[model samples]
Target: MLKNPFLDVEFVPDLMWFIGQFDVYDREETKGAELAVYNPDDECDREKLIVKYGLDLKCLSYRHKFVLVRFLGEKLDDPNFDFQSLFEIGEDCAGSWPRGEWYNLQNPKGFLQDVYVNAKKVWKKDLEKAALEDPSTW
Candidate 1:
């Protein structure tokens, strides 16, 4: 039996929802091959397909784990994911992940986007406050 790594962590409800979505992606017989063949010009259409049929669950989980580790300060055994560079894109930019080549697709409902956007907003506010208090830290 495959071991569950997240058994002990206190996952927020949205993160758990993402995990459930990834579970569906994992259990599907085709293992997300259905998403692999789709090539849509509009990103919204691609996200609609993903919401309808799902994409690579393992890949999605890896991304979630990365956000948990890198942004949320949760540590787990490294899954050897090599896509950390892509996650560094700024707030206004669209990013790509390798799985299914789902280019320019960002689900507004996704936990990663929520965490990232909120984190950036908080950081900007904190930085502005900090700069006023201590210009040397800038």
Candidate 2:
């Protein structure tokens, strides 16, 4: 009984392409540097999603980042999906800088993998719905 219907789709190249533009950096190093370094000028439908979600690049584990891309791809397939809500959710999920000492001390990969798994479980219904609707074109 998934509520959102985009999770079941296959890999989305467009979303992946957009996600590839952002390179994760050390939280401290990103302070003064140009944010544009991570984002290119290439325009696409996924740009807005990138802008919101990409801001959390540093906080996300490398693998967890892909989840966002896949999620976006699913949303793209749904004509009725609300772009505004997606953007808002992205903003809410953006991680904060100067991560706690405990967070910095933990294994980032392991931590993020856990996060990703939990997220998938929470959004499973939505993903299943999406997959059922479009069956993933790609």
Candidate 3:
């Protein structure tokens, strides 16, 4: 019953993230599409973990609803997600949603890597407005 068509995957330890729903305009413009980085194991704070991943405050912005997730607890050597860039595009409470496609990048015999490496414009919604809103939804 989710609006987004992306699947959740944890390739590396402490790096659980979704490939779809990517709305970052540029690598530095990831503020609007960033999901929260949580420490379910109590090893580090959210901010600290984000920093370790080279994600800065400007790189992430919260949206309306939060996605529930936990970081993997292990180490992955150069586990190239094979996706230098990824994003999502859609809206909640909208009926005319686009056809959803669920894909697992890690799957063999898939073109996930080839597409992303040569992608020019990815479709993704900008959810920064939802994150910076006041506690009271005015």
Task: Give each model's whole-structure lDDT.
Answer: 0.37, 0.38, 0.27
- Give the per-residue lDDT digits (tens) of candidate 1, residues 1-138: 112346655333233333233222333446445444544334564444444433223432333433332433231223443223332334565332324333333432243443334434434444344435532221
Error of 2 at 51 (Å): 21
At residue 21, what lDDT does model 2 achieve? 33
Candidate 3, position 24, lDDT: 28
lDDT of 3 by residue, 35-94 (tens): 233321222432233333323223232321222121211111236543322322244422
Find the 10 residues in a row with the least total lDDT in model 2. Answer: 96-105
Rank all candidate structures by their TM-score, best first, as comma-separated numbers. Answer: 2, 1, 3
Every candidate's CA RMSD:
13.6, 14.8, 16.6
Candidate 1 residues lying further than 4 Å off, grouped into runs, are 1-6, 12-29, 53-100, 103-138
Least lDDT summed over 10 consecutive residues: which range in candidate 1? 69-78
Clashes per model (N, Cα, C within 3 A): 0, 6, 7
Residue 75 CA displacement from its true place in model 1, Å = 18
What candidate 3 gets wrong by more than 4 Å, as runs, is: 5-15, 18-47, 52-65, 69-138
TM-score of each: 0.26, 0.29, 0.16
The most accurate candidate by TM-score is 2
Deviation of model 3 at 45, angstroms: 11
> What is the lDDT for 74 in model 3?
14
